[model samples]
Target chain A: MLLYTIYLVAIVAEAMSGAIMGMRRGMDLFGICMIGTVTALGGGTVRDVLLGHYPLGWIAHPEYLLFTIGAAVVTAFVARYLHHLRAVFLLVDGLGLVAFCVIGCDIAMSAKMHPAIVVLAGMITGVFGGLLRDILCNQIPLVLQREVYATVALFTGSLYVGLLYFKVDSSVAQLASIGAGFLFRFLALHFEWRLPNFNGDRIRGFE
Target chain B: MLLYTIYLVAIVAEAMSGAIMGMRRGMDLFGICMIGTVTALGGGTVRDVLLGHYPLGWIAHPEYLLFTIGAAVVTAFVARYLHHLRAVFLLVDGLGLVAFCVIGCDIAMSAKMHPAIVVLAGMITGVFGGLLRDILCNQIPLVLQREVYATVALFTGSLYVGLLYFKVDSSVAQLASIGAGFLFRFLALHFEWRLPNFNGDRIRGFE
Candidate 1:
């Protein structure tokens, strides 16, 4: 029940994030709503698709769209004041990332996916919403380019799977993974942790 | 069978196009293969996922990966000589676009989707691959911005549906749609036709 509540909160946060990006880009109302919904639901949708699991989260629960759309519209009006809440926004977003990872792992595990794929699915759910958001915004995906954000997802998923393997109770595993993942992300943000990127600008002959 | 052959050729062409873009972006070998495969298969994968179709095209036909990966690797090696065949490349790409549209339509029609959605599926199959490729390349999707490319897919799909409604032979409809779609794309390219984009830079208050 708590995870479900976190999931709802996460979608709203992601939608607001998308709405802010769209407003910054000068997109129209429909584009803003579309981007917001995609950012909110895109990760789960992609994870489901990759695993051949379907009826998609939004399709089965249409009210999720209403939540995302409403959040986006509201954000469009109050964006100027949002900077005051930036810290709160970041914390909630990080929390959502861990929740998404845990939820994604549950789906893959239920489907009997390989452990590696289950973790991959978790990482996809945690980060792909923002990846899709960046793509629509016409920018490099921040997670792929640098940030240790994806590392947190990998760690969370792996930890959850490891705990389950060691016979930890499911609920305990979920809470433990989510807590650790959130802490990891928070520390990474505080410390400005980043992954190493190769010299992508160094145009050598393709090797 | 004709459509199947065209599908193979299309994937190869799309993969090569992706490889060239990745190479130009100074992406490494793994990046090149990943981009190439995504470009070649992303549209159909997205279509099936959206439609809630299971088992996905590439999952069922793992050999498709071989085709795309092989084409990408080959292109990386022979890319310098490719510009001389730009016209040929363009033709094949256009042809592939049409073929993809027809195949997408057939799948949706069989799934008993609405006529509008069927047409949409075709357009998605035709353009989303390139849209995704542009996303990974970190640029605005060209088709969404300016090209009449999506228009051709729409037209081809509508014509195919209409012809089938009037009891046209299946083969006749397929050939007719592909021919018209290819011609439309070719002319659009040659004449430099474009769609209008609103002033995205004119940042008014969100409306």
Candidate 2:
């Protein structure tokens, strides 16, 4: 039940974030709705595919699509009001990140994958949706460019795997992981922290 | 061997298209390569997923990635000379569409999918990459909006499925489908044919 709740909340947060991003970019109704649906469902779809879950979560449950559409419509109408609370948006998005990381690890562990692969899959699940969303919108993905974004997910996933190694309670381990992820992301944002880029001639070849 | 040849030609065409599109948009080398990879593999990825194949085609075969990168580099240098041949580009893209459509249907039929689903999947597999490329580049998808774009694939897929239903030889059916798709697209481009949209409010309360 707790996991289900977390998933629902994450979906809502993702939908809201997507709608806001699309509205900020002046996308029309169709574009906003499409973006919202993609953002809300993308991570879970990737996770499901990796885990070999067929039919897909959103395709199996049409309500998620309807909810995303609802969020888009609401955002379209209330964007001017929401624009004043950028901090609140950031906070909600941070919570979503933590929730997704926890759920990703949980799902991977349930699938009985290797701890290292689970950690990697969890990180991909937590960050790939946002990365795809930003790429589609032609914005730099925060998880790719910002400090401790994917790192936070990776850390959280590693912690979950460590606790599992010790035969710890799954819920407790998940909660601890989520807390750690949230804290890491919060601190990174507050401090404007970032990973150092390798500014070498090797990196310049691709440019 | 025929399928392999067609696939290679399609990849080359996609790579060239991506290089031209990227250069036109002033993207750097990495961006150009990324676009080329997406253009070459995007359709196949969607096809594989819809057919319930996991890990994706490119993920299963890393050589496709390497080949796309090589093609991107070659096209990047040659694009300067090729930029003026817009008509040639369209014709090449049309060929790619036909080839991909035939391959998509072949794969679907191999998977024993229903003929209707095979035809639909074939059309989707033929056009989805270009749709994604256009969407990512912030342009309206030509497949969605332009004259006889997706329609060409659809017609070809329908013909392939029809031929299969009539117990036609696989190679003959494939060739006919490719010819039909190419001819449809080419003629549409030459004559500026288009599907009619319901400008009048036939379906009320929708859009």
Candidate 3:
């Protein structure tokens, strides 16, 4: 139940972020809705597809699509005011990251997948939607470029999996993992933390 | 038997094309291989997942993975030479497009999907691997931007389905559809046929 609530908040925030990107690209209303929906749901869709979990999350629950589209249309109309609320959306997006990671890990674990795959699944679920959005908008993905975001998902998922392995109560494990992930992302953003790039020449050559 | 043979040729050509793009982006060997594999198999992977078909094509047939990766690596070493043979590759890519469309339609029909969706399935199978490739490489999808590319798949798929509906011999329908799609694409290329864009100002506002 707690997880579901947080997931809702995260998806809405992500959808709005996607809409802002679409507006930046001057995409049509149709394009804005397309990007927004992909941003809000693409990660879960990819995760579900990878895990072979049938009846995809959005397909099964059409209301999520409505919620995402509604958020996007509202964002399109009010984009000018969005600059003022950057901090608030960042906070929400951070929370959503952790929630998405936890839920992803939980789902993978329930499937009895390898522990390594479970953690990877969590990270993919937390980050791939934004990656898809950036790709569609013709930009390098921020998760791949910037600080500690995908790492936060990986860490939280591993922690949750560890706690469960140690017979920790599920509720305690969930809260602790979420708290740690949120703090990690918040600090990374505040301090402008970044993963060290490989020597510039090699990094540029590959990236 | 004919379909399988054509499918093999198509995947190899697509994989090589993906490798060329990777080289243009100055990507390392891993990136080249990743892009190539995605270009070769991504469409089929996406189609099966959307249809809730388990054991993705590449996973079920590891040999395809090996084949795509091999093609990509070869292209990386021969990218300079690829430009000299652009016409040849273009011809091969066109054939592959039709093969992919036909197979996609066949699979969807076998599953007893809606007729409209079957056509869509064919288009997705024919075009999405390239879409995924372009997205990962950070470009607007050519299928969406170019002349008469995706349209060929749509026409071919619809024709195949129509023929099948009228109880045309499966072999005859397949051959005719493939021939029609190939000819349509060839003519479009030769004539520089393009779907008309919306008025520039209005398109800029929305597209």
Candidate 4:
């Protein structure tokens, strides 16, 4: 019940973020809703599809679509005042990122995926929604170039797996991984931490 | 057998195209191979995932990855000299597009999807690979803004569905649809056909 509640809140938060981006791009209302829904659910959808998990989450429970679409619509109507809640938005987003990673890792582990793949699936679930959003917005993925956003996902997923391997209780492992991951993401943001930004400008040929 | 042969050639051609785009973006060898593979296989993968079809084509036939990656590597090495084959390349691409649409339609039909969904699937199969390529390259998808490339796919799919609905022989339907679709694409390219590009800048709000 707690995870389900977090998942709902997460989708709503993700949808609003996506809607904001769409508005910035001058997209129509339909495009905004589409981007929002995709941003909220696209990562998990991709993970499930890759693992051959049937009946995608949103498809099986169509109501998730309603939540995302509704959030986007609300964001579109009230975006100008949203800056006041930027801190709250970011915090929720951090929580959601870890929650998503944990959920993704659990799915892969249940399916008996390779350990590396389980971690990778969790990272995909955590970061790929934004990746998909960026693609739709016609931009390079921010996570690919920005601070340690995906790194947080990878860390959370690996930790969750590691804890489970050590025979940690399921709920405790989930909460601990999520808590640590959220802190990491928050600190990364606070300190403006980053990985190397590869510059291919000097690289010659093949072009 | 003919369709399978065409599919192989198509993936090779698509991979080369994606490699060229990646090269222009100054991506390294790994990036080039990734873009190439994604461009070649992404369309069908997306189609199958959306339709809940498992054991994806490339997964089932891992050799397809070999063809796409090999093509990409070859392109990266010899791209400077490839300009001379522009006409031939374009012809092959057009043929491939139609073939892909037909194959996609057949799969969706066998799955008992709605006729409209089948046609849409065909169009998605023809276009989404290139769309994914552009996304990786961090640009607006060319097909989304360019001439009637996707239009050709839509036309071909609708025609293929209609032919089948009329109970035409399967082989005849395939050939007829491919031929017509290829012609349509060729003419669209030659004549610079396009759909309306809505200018959303003037439309206020949401941002």
Candidate 5:
């Protein structure tokens, strides 16, 4: 139940981020709404589809769809005033990332998938929405480029799995995973840390 | 059985297109393989997931995945030579689009979804792989820009559904739909038919 609430908060934050990205790209309202909803829901949808879990979350619960659309609309109106609050938005987006990771981990754990698949599921659920957003905006995916983003999700999922392996209470595992993941993401952003790029040298080799 | 064979042909064509796009973007072999596989199979995957179908097609048949990857690798080496065969590729891609549309409509009809949704499923299965490829390549989606691509898919699906409704034999309906759709796509390409853009007038309203 608590996990569900956290999931809602996470989607809202993600939707806001998506709306901002769409607006920055000078997209119309329809485009803004599309990007926002996709960013908020695309990850979970991908995870569910990949896992063959039927009756996708948003499909089963239409309210979540409404909530994401509402978040997008609100962001469209308020984004200009909120430009100075980019840090605050980043903080919330970071929290959203952790929340999504934890929820995804819990779901994967319940499914009893292979450990590697479980961790991958969590990371994909945390990161793929941003990937979709960047793609729609015609930018290289931020997750694929800079920041310790995907790594934070990987760590969070690992921590959650480890806690469960040690017989920790579910709630405690969830809280700890979210807390640690959130802090890790915020620190990464503040420090401007990024993953190493492959530089595409091999393509040149073939050429 | 015929549909299955057509499906295979379609994926190979899409995979080649994806590989060419990846190569043009200077991506390495892995990236080429990734884009190719996604472009070939991504549409059907999206359609199946939305409909809550289990065991995605590529998952059920790993050989299909291998086929797309192989196509990508081959294209990476032979793309320049194949440029002269653009017409042949376009023809095959058109056939693939039609095959995918017919298959998608068949699946959705079997599931007894709403007619509108069945058409939508077909269009998505026909077009989304290209959308995925363009997004990953950081370009405007070809479907959303120029060409009668999605419209052809939509018409193919509608015709198939109509034929089925009129008690046409399934095999005949499928074949006719594929024929009509492929012809339409080829003619559209030859004529340079395109949808009108929204022109982003409303975006200026906010600015």
Candidate 6:
């Protein structure tokens, strides 16, 4: 139940970010709504499908879609006066990243997936939606670029796995993971931290 | 074997389109390569995941990734002198769309999905990569705005289902579906055909 609540909040935050970005780009209301829906649901939908979960969460529960639409509408009306709200969006995004990472690990564990796969799943869940949003918006994803974003999620997943190894309370473990992820991401952004870019000669190697 | 060959060709065409588009957007070589890989693999990846296929195609066979990179390099060098290659891109995209639609339906049928669901899957496969590319390029998806694009795929899917119902050979059905879809799409584009927009007043209590 707690995880579901966090997921709901993350969805709203994602939708708000997408709507604001779309409006800034001068997209029509329908286009803004589409981006908001896609941003909010894209990662979870991908995770669910990859995990073989049928009738994905948003499709099974129409309320999620409705909530995203509501978020988009709210963002559309408020965006004009929120020109300086980048920090707010960033903060919300941080919380969303943490929540999603924890939830992803929890879901993978429930599905009896390997710990390594769970950690990877957590990172993908936490970051892929923003990646999709940036791709759609014609911008380089911040997670893939100028920030210690994906690494924070990875660390959080590690914490979750560590807690599991020690037989910690599941709820406590989840909270710790979320807190660690949120703090790491927040500090990284505050300090303008980023991963080093590779300047190696091998152009075809994976990063 | 034939389906795999068609899929390979579609991937190459998609990679070419992505590389050309990326160069036109002034992206670097790495960016063009990444875009090309995503464009080539995104739709099939989604289809496979949704159909519960494990170890995604590109993940299972990294050769596809190498092929995409090669195509991107070729496109990057060739696109410099092909500023008037819009017609070529359209033709390639049309062929890719038809091939993907047929393969999508075949995969869905193999998975024992309902014919209606298979048709929807085919349409999704046909358009999803282009949708992703348009979103990445910050352009509205032509599939959504251009009427009859999805309809064409659906029509082809219906033909495939019909052929199967009559005990036609699978290869023959696939070829007929591809030809029908490509021709329908081409005619629609040439004639500037469109679906009529909803003109009725928004109905209350309907989402």
lDDT, candidate 5, A100-201, per-residue tens: 887777677778898888888888889999998888878878787777989999999999889988999989998999998888888898888888778686
Instruction: Write out the backbone clash pairs for model 6.
Output: A136-B135
lDDT of 6 by residue, B98-149 (tens): 8888877877787777676577568668878767777777775655444566
Positional deviation of residue B73's Cα in model 4 after best superposition, in angstroms: 16
Task: Give per-residue lDDT, candidate 1, residue B140.
Answer: 73
Runs in model 4 deviating more than 4 A are B1-53, B56-131, B140-207
- Please tell me the interface RMSD, in Å, for model 1: 5.7
Each model's lDDT:
0.87, 0.75, 0.85, 0.87, 0.83, 0.78
Candidate 2 chain B least-lDDT 10 residues = B198-207
Candidate 6, chain B, TM-score (2 decimals): 0.87
DockQ-better candidate, 2 vs 4: 4
Over 4 Å off in model 2, which ranges? A50-53, A197-207, B1-44, B50-127, B135-207
The TM-scores, one per candidate, come to: 0.61, 0.59, 0.61, 0.61, 0.61, 0.58
- In model 3, pairs of residues that clash are A28-B206
Q: What is the DockQ of each candidate?
A: 0.13, 0.07, 0.12, 0.13, 0.13, 0.08
| TM of chain B, each | 0.97, 0.90, 0.96, 0.97, 0.96, 0.87
Residue B168 lDDT, candidate 6, scale 0-100: 96
Residue-level lDDT tens digits of model 3 in A48-130 = 88898766677557678778889988877777766778888888999998899898898888899999999988998999999
CAPRI accuracy category, model 2: incorrect
On the 0 to 100 scale, the lDDT of residue B68 in model 6 is: 92
Q: What's the CA error at residue A167 for candidate 1, in Å?
A: 2.5
Candidate 6's TM-score reads 0.58
Model 6 residue runs over 4 Å out of place are: A53-55, A198-207, B1-48, B51-126, B132-207
Task: Please provide, for model 1 over A1-207, each residue's C-alpha lDDT reduced to its tens digit, 9 standing for 90 to 100.
Answer: 999999999999999998999999999899999999989899998888788886889999999999999999999888999999999999999999999999999998998766766886898898889889988898766665556778889899999999999999999999999999999999999998875333433433322
Better of 2 and 6 by TM-score: 2
